[model samples]
Target: MFWKDKYEVGVELIDNQHKELFNRVEDFLKVIRSTTLGEKKAQKVNETLEFMKAYVVEHFRDEEEYQLKIGYPDYEKHKQIHDNMVSFVLEVSEEYEKSGYNDALIQKFAGRLLTWLINHVAAEDQKIADYAAKREGI
Candidate 1:
């Protein structure tokens, strides 16, 4: 999915991280859709999976900290959402590895990750932006 300017939250660090997130996810999508075949494709998938495992947790931590900094009323609930997503990612990652890098598992992961990121940023995350803006009279 495209990273629109509207997704920016007036926080340079967070906005940059979000943009990088979109780029990484797009790379993941390309690797999945590429027709390279054999180990080459699997290699890229493995690389992306490894990057995402840590990157996602880092991003969520930063995002949650931002929410708490601004005293967002929904901080608790938002954190819960992040926690749930992280749990899902870890679970899937473990299963995917256990199954010897199953193609279907990663494919399913990419699809769900795409949907979750888009919806979370476009919907749930927008609330934080709105709250920040209103607080700052922006």
Candidate 2:
């Protein structure tokens, strides 16, 4: 939900991308938590969703490139994680549209996104950083 200093992997570009991701996700959560629920709020939610779709793809590409550059041992596994997330986002976006932008669906998506992002950054990503540190002396 929030970016912490401890999350830094000591790779400047990747760390900055992670921070940007955290910031965007935090803002998305804040918008979802807002009490105003109507055309205005729905517009904001749609905007955030759009941003997520594009930004997530870009971030994942950069992360994957970083992994490839470093010859990360678990690069395949990490890429699978990214692929799964992309698929989930696409599926959710379709469902959101089919449901006429239902508030409940959006809320569920937000909750899942929050948990997923935290776990990915705090746990999964840390593994990559640990390996890079140990193998490459980063």
> Which candidate tops TM-score?
1
**After superposition, which runs of candidate 1 have C-alpha atoms over 4 Å from their true positions?**
none
lDDT of 2 by residue, 28-74 (tens): 77877777756666776677778778988998898889889878888
The C-alpha local distance difference test score for the whole of candidate 1 amounts to: 0.84
Evaluated at residue 126, the lDDT of candidate 2 is: 90
TM-score of each: 0.92, 0.90
User: Which residue window of length 10 is worst by lDDT in model 2?
Assistant: 36-45
The alpha-carbon lDDT assigned to residue 111 of candidate 2 equals 88
lDDT of 1 by residue, 1-138 (tens): 578888887788878888888888888888778767667667877777787788888988898899888899999999999899888888887887788667788888889888888888888989999999898895
lDDT per model vs. reference: 0.84, 0.83
The true-versus-predicted C-alpha distance at residue 114 of model 2, in Å, is: 0.8
